[model samples]
Target: MLGGAGVLLGVAAAPAQAAEVSYATECIPPAAAGLDPVQGTTKVEVTAPATAKVGDEVEVVWKFVQAASKNPDLIDLPANSVQPSGTLKAAGAQSGDIAMQGPRENPAIAKGGAMVLSDMKGKLKLTTPGEVTLTPDAYAINVMSTDTKCSPKETVKSAATINVTAGDGGSPPASPDPTEGTSPPPTSGEPSPSESESGSAGGGGGSDTGGSGGGGGQTDFTGKEVAIPYACKTPIGDKNATSPVQINAKKDGGSYDLTVQFKGSVMDSPADIPADSVKPSMEVVLGGADKGKVHVEGPTNSEAIKSGDPMEIPDLTGTYKPGADGKSTLSPGVLTVKALGTTTTCTPTKSAVSLTLDTAAQEGGAAGGSAGGAGVSGSGAGGSGGGLADTGADDGGMLKALGLVAGTAVLLGGAVFTFMPRRHASRKAP
Candidate 1:
């Protein structure tokens, strides 16, 4: 009788499974129409210790660069025109952007005209034991001068990952008592209270797969929210300390369906941020994709995220390829919302964002035919620099070269004319 009931439940739930995929697809918006992103690209590089203990504070240095000569020009305004800021906060650590205005020193212009924004630094306090992906929020820069009539916007985003291990004997310090042995923390290896509850719910249905069963393969972010602070000048000269963003993942066959929602105050980022003036978007470069592809999708205001409603980032649904080690690393991309009303673009609070995926269960069962399982690789660094120095030939030098060429041509013509006349006269005399 119990087995028969289980079968009936499965049959009823089949429609829900199809709905999950449809929902995921509709959430993430397609690329903008007629607006091709700048031909230039940016990269992010990091410098930090390989491993650190929980509760320890560490400094993470970031170097942003414009990869090639085709790199787009950064928004150049007076120092106070637009505020450039970001944060180092991630899953385990707590930190903030070091320089509020911009990088302390002007970035260097390297050979091949690569723009390098180096020495931008920040600190993070490790609170949990696990690998944390550090992706600063989308730092908007002015791509045009202050005089432009209508200034379209561009963004700067990069990522890095840091591993935080347990302090004593590779275990998190749970209690202050010295006698108590080290155990992993809440976000660590051991199951959390929520995960345990989720697992119990799944066990009853006989659908509990390997690992913590949050919908069998889903990553549950039930009560938690990712906070990203932002500050800007021009349109609204204020800073938002807390902007709550949520990410929910559900297993969809071999892939995962993700739903990202924005909650809390509608005026968090900008109190009166005009919905039409603001272009909200997100770009993700995950390693688990087909061929190490960077997927850019957003402008969610149309479908998933509306101006007044709590916007949801949809279509983050895809199968993650596991690496050779049976695990896939994830680097978080920037969530950008640009305001075209003014020339300035603000920055997000958390820049370095990342997550991990355990694909061993799926690989062992269905994807075992592949040789090397796919995994998420770390993202590269971007660079920025001041405008190229004036190095071309001056007007005086150009005139001088022109004059010399003209004089040489005249002299040669005169010599030919003189010699030809002499030869003709000699022939007549003979």
Candidate 2:
């Protein structure tokens, strides 16, 4: 599934040199699972062109060996359900991080069986004519819906280096065809950048519900992975977080079916979070040929979380329909999470487009798609209904009760505290 998600940049002209590097890595399963961290060695072989012209886009591949640890869960995992995502930290001539993702090609593994990760590739565009060093950074292996974040326990050696030279003002030479070694593109309607950017623009500005825009082509991004950054208000303070969102869209009769999945994230809580106290909602913003927002809400957690333990938010799902025609870009907007009596709102700090699709205009006043259905609520433009599900409890009363309980516990000296902080050290998920 991941193999088809690769972007087709131009190929290089010459054969690239690959370097093999192995290092020790430590991984921690999702905090909600309450599993101990494990240490293992990771071996990766990196391939990149030894030399490239400035401003040329070069492909870099990181092939991995068998994982250090096996499947830790009890159930057997099916093939191609595990996806790997990581960062290639670049230094020297180049100064930014390159996001690398691999196809979900893992073989079926029984519980506690050895795990294998797929090779990851990223495209790096050479800007300055100098040498650049690339080293593997922290990565995450998402099995099913759970994630195990891994990082090198020590300083990692460089995986590969590239020397860049000034290029002539002419067109770049073509390298080997990507199809020679990579998997073929999927037959599904995964739109290319060119196709997604095409189409005439027409749509309304602000409405919580209803269709806006003119008719155009359709773009299906069922399993695509999108990373969005959020600034969230936590019980402790304001903290920044990133969520890996998976989007699915299909054209139904007169309306489009859209499903947004939040892969889950590790959060901190200053107080105990009761079961079913937290609900999350997402606002998907539309741009390009159409303009508006679609709101999707998720369910609450089933288990109680003690204070100081990592708070894991369950995945959210919702559907929306588009009425307008033409290409519209969907980007993550505001994320609101309601826990206990307190509400934590997270807003996108940057403009990150998740997917773009063309929709056909609905004729005969077909009631445009509404966000409310399929275990989640959806609202179109100007909808006042909050994206989050109502707990039906009084927020002020709940907060006041919690405060009294905390005060009584302090007076009775019956308070208990447990804290197990996350241990990636200086490494952060890229």
Candidate 3:
């Protein structure tokens, strides 16, 4: 009697098993809650081109949920946890995009970190044309800048594991997939995603037997909100001080206001360096990305550093919004600097300036550590002439160079023409 009941249940549940995949999704920002995510989940489903047959358009799905903490610690935050989930389609359709949806950054001063979203789906594609079989392997999901160390097209690596192999019963492996940890071997790993979607211009109807193939293997969707772990990650009180430190600069330490240039390089002499140490050099950058529109000033909007003394830039704790007219007043002891980034109201208790002095034997470097006991080695000394005298080339440096070249060329050409013999043919002898 029990056997009969079990058979009846199995038959009834067959249709349900064939339904599309679904699951819960939990989004996270590592420390936003002052604890690891205690309850969350993420669901993933795959889509393929209509033309693909059931066998052709393979898909995969993943579902996850965060567990509540039963621990007694003020709050529970788990790290390095794993919740395994999989789908048949995910394994079959290997030559396509794989993606994940969410992550968010929290700006709470009490709990702030980098906001980031891991879109694992974008990385799927065919390395070669045709049906490329995908297999599970270790992978990473990462954010990338326009740098040489990353793949431009795929930003997310959805599957850190894959398994692709022929299964018995006229179908691929069923639940508890045996192909775990292995993927169909790729022909070559040289930047495979670039050419996967367009199909082979060089070959036809090739078998994705061991690689990527078919169409619409990947999908793109909004990335889940996530905070970058390192965004504004510097410690609250850390200071970034520069070299050839000045007190109050005149005209932002320049010839005029709205144009302070800090020469970021220092002259170095090996003779000045101790035999036990390496000569130090300046490689610091000062000024804004749009260096033309920025200037230095003390509290009260008094243009330039008139004091010729070191200024202690306080932490900015208020909102600072620059007016359309590009003018703002600095609170006393707070340095007001306008640049291209977001308007920061807090004064920089932590300031950074590039030192041009030789670091020959200077202890604690501006880079390796603090500026403590560091020497700005030069006879030119502080206020030798002016603090910011060699800070940097003015924003007008490029324009000046161009003007000089053009003027010199014009003068030289005129002189050459005047000195050359003029042919005054004798009244056109013809």
* Pick by TM-score: 2 or 3, better one: 2
What lDDT, from 0 to 1, does candidate 3 have? Answer: 0.20
- Writing each residue's lDDT as its tens digit, candidate 3 over 47-95 gives 3322221122233332221111111211111111111211222333343
In model 1, the Cα lDDT at residue 29 comes to 8
Could you tally the backbone clashes for each prediction?
Answer: 33, 17, 65
lDDT of 1: 0.30
Question: TM-score, each model?
Answer: 0.25, 0.39, 0.23
**Model 3 regions more than 4 Å off:** 1-41, 48-258, 261-343, 350-430
Which window of 10 residues has the lowest lDDT sum in candidate 1?
17-26
lDDT of 3 at 308: 18
TM-score, predicted candidate 2 vs. hidden true structure: 0.39
Lowest summed lDDT across 10 adjacent residues in model 3 is found at: 221-230
TM-score winner: 2
Task: List the candidate 2 regions with Cα displacement exceeding 4 Å.
Answer: 1-12, 169-430
Tens-place lDDT digits, model 2, residues 166-280: 6666543354221222222212111111111111111212222122222355433443344454555433234444445544555556555556654333334333444665566
Best by lDDT: 2
